[model samples]
Target: MMPTIVFGVLSVIIIGFALAMVLSKNLVHSAIFMAATFVGVAGIYLTLSAGFLAAVQILIYVGAISILMVFGVMLTRRGDISASNLFNKRIISGVVVSAALFIILGRLILTSEWFPSSFSVPESTVGPIADLMMNAYVIPFETAALILLAAMVGAIILAKGARRTR
Candidate 1:
């Protein structure tokens, strides 16, 4: 009972923070709200007994990505409040596309008949996960690292160029 109540509260916090992020006028404030949403999601993951995922969510998303987004926001000179006219052209199109996708997904879920499986996940999945990451997916993981490195280098170059212009 207590767990359910806690889960519900966390869920509400997550949703509220996500909405706050979208509605925030300030880009930097939006980034901070997004970080709050990420932290809330990490808490929800903890409630679901996914400790590892919760840790990764907090560390990678809330810690690294949120910091990067804030830094990117700081690098720009744009003011906090954007005019309503900024989204005038594509709003209807975006809404229609999203609604269509939602309808399709809802239909698919409702029509699908999933069977109950007796199979259960292993109690110790961490070892296998690490093994797969190190052995099977190492190349792809390293490629992602290389891509991030390139992005970091590009950001540095752009910062340098801006400094020179000033």
Candidate 2:
């Protein structure tokens, strides 16, 4: 009963903040809502007893990614935030497509056979997963980090060049 209640509240938080993030014009506000959504997702992970996933969600998505986005927006944003994504002819078409998608997804959900699970998740899966990531996948992880660094450097160079042109 308690878990179900928590899950319900978390779900509401997730959905509400996600919609707020999408609808918000201010980039900073959107980033804040995005962080809230990430937190809600972490709460759901906690409810499912996925402690590691919850930690990663909070650390990576909420802590790092959201902060990075907010800072990026603050630094790069010119006169107004709403300068981009202005309403146009695309709005009507986008609404129609999204509504059709929602209806199709709703039909799929209604028809799906979702029974209570007899199989339970294991108590702790952190150890083996940690070993695999740290030992076996270490190279891939380092490579990804290097790639991200290169992208950041490229962005900085582009920004500087654009400023010089202006």
> How accurate locally, in lDDT, is each candidate?
0.82, 0.87
Tell me the lDDT of model 1 at 22: 69
Candidate RMSDs in Å, in order, are 3.8, 3.3
Against the hidden reference, what TM-scores do the models get? Answer: 0.70, 0.75
Clashes (candidate 1): 0
Task: State the lDDT at 35 in candidate 2.
Answer: 100
**lDDT of candidate 1 over 1-166, digit per residue (tens):** 9988998999899889986786666777778899999999999888766677789999999999999988876666465345321434666787799789979998999999989567665576467778878899999988999999999999899989989999
| Best lDDT among the predictions, by candidate number | 2
Measured by TM-score, the strongest candidate is 2
- Backbone clashes, each candidate: 0, 0
The worst-scoring run of ten residues by lDDT in candidate 1 lies at 79-88
Report the C-alpha lDDT of model 2 over 4-97, residue by residue, as the tens digit.
8998899899999998887776778889999999999999988887888999999999999999998988887788776543444476788799
Candidate 2, residue 147: lDDT: 100
